[model samples]
Target: MTLIKKEGPSQMDVVTATASVSDQDSTKDVSPATKDSHTSPADPTEAGLRLYDHGGMVLVPTPTSDPKDPLNLAVWHKCMIIFLVGSYSAFSVLGTSGLSAVYPSLIQAYPNESPARISDLLTYPTLFMGIGNLFSMPLCVTVGRRPVFLFSLLMLIVTGFWCAFSDSLGSHVAGRSFFSMAAGQSEALAPYIVEEVHFLHERSTKLSWFIGVQTVGTAAMFVATTYIVPSMGIKWWYLIITFVNVALLLLSYLFVVETKYERVEATDGAIVHLNFAEADDSRDSESGAVRNGLRLRPDIHGPRTWQHDLRLFHFKPVWSETFTFYKDTFKSLAIPSILWLLLLNGAFLGIYVYQASTFAQVLMSPPYLFKFAYLGWVQLVQILDCVLLVPVLGYGTDLLAKVMCRWRKGVFQPEYRLISMSIPGIAAVIGCVIYGQAAAHPTQWSWMGVVAPYHLGYFAFLGANLVSITYAIDSFPRKAGPVLLVICAGRGFISFGLSYSTVPLISKTGYDGAMNIFAIISGVLAGIAVPMYFLGTRFRLWAMQRLWPKLNQ
Candidate 1:
């Protein structure tokens, strides 16, 4: 009777008892500890990997598994990363634009200097901006991003203060050299942005915003200093900018967390998601307890004191290390995407540096009849440029990816990103022509309508350059930084040559011829995208097949 009662049941009772037995079996087969240890197999389709610490805590590792991660960025911890990576972009533009307003004052302070000599003060910083990267590229990657950024910032801050008070060309040149030393930060920024962000899908948009903000910061400094110099005097302008930079330094100290992470999966800096205290507690008895509470310390660059850090200047016989770095820096030249990057960046940078120098001279001085501050108001168009591009640039690139993904039956290709370059490329050429022609024939044209094209072209320029860089980085996934470094070096050289010579180029060619030349060159090259779109697919496939093996080896 007892057996019958125990065995007997309505169908429901039988099902319930069987389920209870199965649950017991499952519990016995997989202990809670075992269940906690295993990740529910990742979707292989996703590119990133899962990271687990000692306490059964999981983190999404950076984008790669190798000793070096692409960007090693994390989700939800980007503000600091953006700030740190972005610091260089800010420095680059500020150094260039700030001096434009102060040139006359600089001339007054250092009389007996030719306009060309004064311009050297302006030009050399950019020259160094590019040259400094020559050294920083290999060093940053070999040493680390944080150390280079810190050292650069320190050099910039100290030298900048000295520059504000200096009365001689030699001292100013020394200040500018330090300014150049810090310039590598900008070259490093793009890779940092791409590496530490969400994914290939999200990189373009983020990069666009980063570039756009940098433009605003750069443009505003020019516009601001234009007025401030007149009222506050040049020394005050320098002092004010230096003080603003001090704020930037403080921000870096406080919020800009170290990006270098231990777990290969840690993509962003200072993993905010993990509860450090709780993680420590959970793994207190574990053999790998050290890994649980792994917050990165500030001195990740080894225990080099400030004096030792400065002594890098004296660290000789470093030829072996230096040679290795230069070898890596040159790696980008071998990639075709680098050519596109070099062309696009060099063109854009040249036009911008040239225009910034000449436009004020051409417009404010003669036929346009505007004063410096009023000329500053001309930058209002830049406002429109940013207004139009900011919301769309990143998202537009992503949209291009989606459209391309569909075209390929749901497979994504690097070539798809190239399509976004066309509109901007054409816009750039047209802008150069308008800006040049209008300045040449001021009597024949209204300055307002003429200036409109230049600003409009800038919008497209930003979009296209953003497209070019993002695509190149994505396409050459393994060598993004090295590629950008080469591109930047080329751009630096271009910027240096054009900035110094633009006055001469414009004087020799006249505004009409100069603009026409740039227009034609850019227009002809703009067609590169059409072929790029058509042939780009085959090229990328061919390159990927040919290069990845070489790159890996």
Candidate 2:
């Protein structure tokens, strides 16, 4: 009667009724929830228990009777995890992108510093964030993800205060840098959280949705700060951020569960994953144990008490493993596919930041000299850009993956998701070209024409960014921790390089030449997608069989 049916195009986000999502969406007529489910003989590879629903949707990870297991947690509990993951990461985008909204006020407040010096408030923290990526994952893995997240929130709150009260530019830069270092944890840890809680079918939508939430939240902050700084002053604006961080910390404490669960591996030492597009017709049956999209767990363990969740000490606090992670981080970098995904993901991040750094500068000067406060309203473009992109990136990728797997006779590969990158990749190139031309000659184009396409360029980079990450996690589900840290650290470094080069490059080559050069770089990197589509699965399978154990060892 409602969208609560799990079989169709997976519901994008929560709408109250719990929805079931499958990588391979069922197209046949299936009985209703209360109807009895009929299943075929059990799989015998390991003396199989029933795993398929009546419509042949393979329950990811095969639902367990253990209530404490993450997969078996109440639907409401999983939803809470989803909300917290998106919310904390969304909050981090403010320190990075939203800071630019206050630049006009900052220049007036510190009349002694040049505009370029004021931009350091944005630049220095970016560099520190890359440095923070080096440690973000190891701490999550070695100490426990929950503790690391909690600690990062505390630091964000503390640093926000330091930034608000700072009397000198040097002190403010130091404060912002530390704040970004903490913010890096949220970004670096997000992928791991996505992999931990979601089923295979649900991953694409959940990941893209969270990324969208952050991007939209960032713009909303821009809109807020622009208006706030003019009326209350920049100092008061930061105080507002500090209060928000405190509230986020309180919410995180209530909801975020530690997501460091042990995953199962197959006989050849590969991770066991189910691809719904490959469903065997022989198993087109179901189990009565599954009802209303939940695995009916026995009451043997009793109801899970809050203590299993609220306890602070989940691990032994292994400080020594931090060194182990540091070593593995570099070792993981040598692997070819891992490296490609890392660079691909980082390049898009670099592109996004470059646009963020330049957009305010260009819009505030010359043919269109916009007032500082007015720039906040311009964020509507960014907000609209993300809103338009969420469905295309999230649902589009999931649907593409489902169809491609069916086309391949049910053999689903990670490369199937990369197809989502094609349109966005080209859009990025075009957007860069148009933006450079607009920036170089302001008289020819109106503000609407320039900013719309310029902000719209985000469509490509964000799509590419999410695709590269989703594919990597799919390829190496077990290596989610180490691999994510590598990508985050790489992007952090890449962002620093792009931010440092931007002003000098613009000065030497003119805005047109500087941005066109980025267009070329972006286009060239994008070319790799074709080969990745054709060759990615082979490399992933080989690594799973041959390379995975060696890197882990």
Candidate 3:
């Protein structure tokens, strides 16, 4: 039950040595193979292979001797990889939403086109961002994280240049769609990479940081592009995006190593093995070599070095495994608890997009009369929400889980995270009510009043999103990657549809009526968490016991 460095002999040498001893000690006249078979099962400790133990705390999925194992890598190295991938994810989003500020200039350039056509520049890209996940997720799962990410970045850079120079509407839309498709990996794969490198205790906080950077990128782009478009031109704005992508691509090539590792949980359920080596009596392999698991190899030949990481370019897809992955992803939707979580995330995104699409139109008319240049400043509220509220919600939930675990005699349950959702859920309901009512009387309340609810609503909405995603991942760690793909694609598509219908819905229902309707929907969705909080553990247990087996089949 203690971690010890076995540097003198390879793992196979130890296994052979143990086999010889077991054969001599056997009561019956059994062969060496027979003795190993009997001892391996009887001992239950894998013949003294050390279990990672630190001060009575066992490392789940015990790290291998291999320095390239992400868990075994130096803490600084892990942080550097996380930072690099996170930056790539954030910049992808920045590119996706950056053009929102330049719509006016685009309209002038294509005078024959309707405003709606110009709007497609943004809408099409958003739609493709989600669609791209279908392809990106499979590629990342099969080939490798580094190669897929590099490919996506290359597409992003090329499409960015195409968008910057294209003169025709047709060409622009095409370029933007391709650009978004490439950027989609940021949403689909970034969280998966985080999970691959970090432990259970570190997941929620790390994921929060990743999600936060994405929001920052989206918000920062609006502010930067807003100024760039008015001061320079739309082309210059895209050029800036292109330049940033080039820089990120270079960083990714040099530093971002492969994170995919074959992790196996211990059968006794006491620990997890990050790199397991199955015993083979037929061959006397090297000390660190194992036939069935990731063998302990030098960092230079494994994931740690650029030369080894370049192997990601070799595309190899196991068709049956890929098919099974897709099947399981779809099957996961049948679980009600998971379905509800996805809906909650999608509802928040729908509301966010609806508000973003309408806020400019509402403020520009009548009493406030804010100019287009100033409209981009509205995102500052969202930026503040991310900065102040995200840490409180992210780390706050992690702390809550830890405290609850201590109270429960050091046993952690995924349900502990749901308790923190109540506050944000209620806040969202109130924010929606205020925003809905304020939009009805823009002139009377002034733009400030209308915007106040927005700040509150978005803050609460994002908090709920962060908590729910973390909860889902914790509840189903093995399936989290594909599940996240479903969430990302589902929410994006839903948001696109909601955004498209916003103006028509508002015109038909009037701003107050529409907002009220949306408020009711938001409240109902957020309120689902109340019952879930009280009864979620039972549901999770039920799924594990009943639903999971069925889904696997």
Query: How well does each candidate superpose onto the true structure, as a TM-score?
Result: 0.74, 0.83, 0.81
User: Over the stretch 184-244, how does candidate 2's per-residue lDDT look in tens digits?
Assistant: 8766686567656666656778777777777777777878888888889767877888898
lDDT of 1 by residue, 371-407 (tens): 7676666765576776666566677777777665544
- lDDT of each candidate versus the true structure: 0.57, 0.66, 0.65
How displaced is residue 508 in candidate 2, in Å?
2.0
TM-score of 1: 0.74
List the candidate 3 regions with Cα displacement exceeding 4 Å: 1-62, 264-306, 313-316, 541-553
Q: Per-residue lDDT tens digits of candidate 3, residues 1-553?
A: 1222122221111111111112222111112221221112122222222222111222333444354566654455567776777777777876777666566777777899998888898787778999998888877777777888888888988998998899899999999999999988876687777766765555667777776776767677777777888788778888888898899888778767777766432221122212122221112234443211224445434534546654555446665766766776786687666778778777777776777667777777887888887777887566777675556777777778767655643445566777877766666666666666667787567677667667777776677666776777766665666677777777778888887888899889877787777777777877787777656656654554464544322
Worst 10 residues of 2 by lDDT: 9-18
| Best-performing candidate as measured by lDDT | 2
The TM-score obtained by model 3 is 0.81
Number of clashes in model 3?
A: 5
lDDT computed for candidate 1: 0.57
Ranking by TM-score: 2, 3, 1
Select the stronger candidate by lDDT from 2 and 3. Answer: 2
Model 2's TM-score against the true structure: 0.83
